[model samples]
Structure formats: structure tokens, C-alpha cells
Target: MDRQDAESAVRVLSGYPTEEEVAALIAVLAVVGQAARAAPGPEAAGARPGRIPAAAFAAGYQSPTSWQAS
Candidate 1:
């Protein structure tokens, strides 16, 4: 999603997220967005071996819980 879409979704969340939570969300979104934009399209199908789809990457993501872990 684009910046505006991200902003809209955050605005609609049930409860207000803490500043740190929002920052973390934004960071995750930024990484995913960059990956999605950089990902090869269907035209490059079968060109790479063991290529993981971006969706799968996002689905398997584990956010860091503390500064030390991060």
C-alpha cells in the first residue's frame, strides 16, 4: 500500500497505538513496500530458483520486541 493508504488504515484502528507502536508499524510497512516494489513481476517467472514470494516474506515476519533484540 501507499503512504496515504497506510495512514488511513492506522487512523481506523480500534484503539490508538502508542507512538512506539506506530513507529514500528511504519518501519515494517516501509520494508514491505520496498520489497514489493523491488520484486520481479510475473514476466520473470521461473527465472530464479527457490524464490520466495513477497507475501510469504511478510507473512513470516517476526517483529523485534526490544532494542537489544532489534
Candidate 2:
């Protein structure tokens, strides 16, 4: 957004922040906006968990078993 939009939005929020504070807030907001655009979407991040392949338990396979005390 342009300077005008930023200024107008700031006017709506409570408190009377100084010019420096406003500038800092805008700078942080700009970084966050940029990061959000660059980052991957939620769907892309929700990957399914992987399971062991069937071959892992195929014939002659010796899967580790817990030690028995009996």
C-alpha cells in the first residue's frame, strides 16, 4: 500500500504514536507482508507422514524384536 493508505489506517487505531514509532511499525509491516508473499501456503506445508515400505518386512527380512526374559 502507498503512504496515503498507511497514514489513513494508522489514524483509525487508538493511541497517539510519534512519527518515528509509526515509521517503525510500517517498516515491520512491510517486512511481514513481503515474507507472507514469499512463504509457501499452508496446504503445501501439510505433508502426509511417511510409512515404512512393504519390502521392509518381506521374506527373509529380520525385523528387530524386543528381547525376551522368559
Candidate 3:
């Protein structure tokens, strides 16, 4: 989504957002959507083969916790 649309979505979801927050939110959404599209799934049409390793996941969660989260 464009910055204005993203900001409007944030406002609809969480009330209101400052200009800086909106920009950050837009960036975050872009990155997150990129990552999600890159992840292994039926929805990941045209994605490369093989699973993305757990290490490729955000670093906070341990492998064991990730297994449990699945």
C-alpha cells in the first residue's frame, strides 16, 4: 500500500498515528509483506523451493520455541 493508505489503515486499526509513526508503519508493512511472501506456503506462488530455515526467522525465538509455535 502507499504511505497514505498505510497510514489510514493504521489509524483504522489503532486509532491515530503521527507522521513519523505512519512512515515507520509503512516501512514495516513493506518489509513484513516481503518476508511473508518469501516464506514457504501454498500462497507463496513463484517462491523458491525449500523451507526457509528457522534461523531466517526473526532472531528472538529459539528453535525449540519455534517448533512449539508451529
Candidate 4:
């Protein structure tokens, strides 16, 4: 690995910030990262409901509607 990458993961682009400020930022980032990983994700938002085809109805498939109501 490159010397810079191995030494540090953060870089200063502008004014120098105190060590406490960097520590706080890193803590917040770590909490948010953990929350995101534990989440059920976008796919778990809800059921992927879709309209039943006319042919399915002809074959006696029950329609779905009650769940769509807000």
C-alpha cells in the first residue's frame, strides 16, 4: 500500500481543525454507517404490488385493493 494511504484515511484541504473536531466527525460517521448497515434496506420498504392481468381474473384470481389505501 502507498505510504499516505497506510498512514491516514483523512486529508486536510483547508484550515487546520483541532483533534477533538476530527474525533467528533469520525464518531458521527461511524454511528451513521452502523445504522445504515443494520437497516432492512430499500427493498424491504413494502410489498411490490401490481395490477392483476385480465386473464388472471377470468381464471378466478381475487383482486387486491384494500392494502393500497392510505
Candidate 5:
């Protein structure tokens, strides 16, 4: 959406936002949505019952094997 449209939506959704702040907030929201969608299923499940970590967080931080040189 354009600057004018985002600003109007922000006003209705929350309150009036300045031009610069509105633009930045829109960009931030986009990134947040992207990350949420890209997150792994278990990691995104949060504190729901019956869920447990399959691996330690430290062990989970692995480089993309597909990108490594053979």
C-alpha cells in the first residue's frame, strides 16, 4: 500500500501517525509477518500443551547444508 493508504489505516486501527513513522511501521509489520510465516512449525507453536523441543536451541543453529560447497 501507498503512504497515504497506510497512514489512513493506522489512524483507524490505532491513531494518527506521522508520515515517516507510518512508513516505518508498515515496513516493520511486513518483516514481522514474513518471519512468522517462515518460522519452523514447532518453533512457532509457542507454549501450547503436548509440545516439546525435539532438539536443543544450540544444536538447532546449523548452517544451511545445501549452500555448503561439496
Candidate 6:
């Protein structure tokens, strides 16, 4: 999607974010969408809770690490 399309979508979903913020959000969404599209289809077509595809990690997606006291 182009910048205008991304801005329009962000406007509809958000409350007046700065243009820079909208652009950043769009970039992030694009990366996530691309990763999702590249991932292989579900294995065996059965529900599996808490199972993230390995491709997502390879694409730089990370789960939240446990918080540690500094």
C-alpha cells in the first residue's frame, strides 16, 4: 500500500497520530504481513495453542522476555 492508503487506514484506526508515527506503524505492519505471508501453512490443519511458526522468529519476531529486576 502507498503512503496515502497507509495514512488513511491509520487515521481510521487511531486518534490523530503524528504523520511520522503513522508511517512507522505502517512500516511495521508491512514487515509483519510479509512475514505472515511467507510462513508455511498450518501443519495438519488442527488447532494448536501457543504455537508460533519458526519462520516468524527467523523473520525477527520475538516473544516478550521475562522481566528481570535491575
lDDT of each: 0.72, 0.68, 0.72, 0.64, 0.69, 0.76
Q: Model 5, 11-41: lDDT tens per residue? A: 7578766777778778999999999888776
Candidate 5 structure, TM-score to reference: 0.38
For residues 1-70, could you state the per-residue lDDT of candidate 3 as single tens digits? Answer: 8998776777857967778777877899999999988877853554456655555567655567678988
Among all windows of 10 consecutive residues in model 2, the one with the lowest summed lDDT is 61-70
Q: What is the lDDT of residue 56 in candidate 6?
A: 74
Instruction: Tell me how many residue pairs clash in candidate 4.
Output: 0
Candidate 6 residue-wise lDDT, 1-70, digit = tens:
9998787677757788777777878899999999998887565455365797777779987666623432
Q: Could you say which candidate leads in lDDT?
A: 6
Deviation in Å, model 4, residue 69 alpha carbon: 36
The residue-by-residue lDDT of candidate 4 on 1-70, one tens digit each, is 6976433434433445557657866898999999999988644754344645566679976645644663
Instruction: List model 1 lDDT by residue over 42-69, tens digit each.
Output: 6577535656567655897543454458
Estimate candidate 4's RMSD in Å.
14.9
Per-residue error (Å), model 2, residue 27: 0.3
Candidate 1 structure, TM-score to reference: 0.41
What 10-residue stretch in candidate 3 is worst by lDDT?
A: 42-51
Query: Which residue runs of candidate 6 sit more than 4 Å off their true CA positions?
Result: 1-14, 43-70
For candidate 2, write residues 1-70 as lDDT tens digits: 9997677567747566668778978899999999999998644756434644455557555544623432
- What's the candidate order when arranged by decreasing lDDT? 6, 3, 1, 5, 2, 4
Candidate 5, backbone clash total: 0
Question: Which parts of model 2 are misplaced by more than 4 Å?
Answer: 1-14, 45-70
**Candidate 5, lDDT over the whole model:** 0.69
By how many angstroms RMSD does model 2 differ from the true structure?
13.7
Per-candidate TM-score against the hidden true structure = 0.41, 0.41, 0.39, 0.40, 0.38, 0.41
The CA root-mean-square deviation of candidate 1, after full C-alpha superposition on the true structure, stands at 14.3
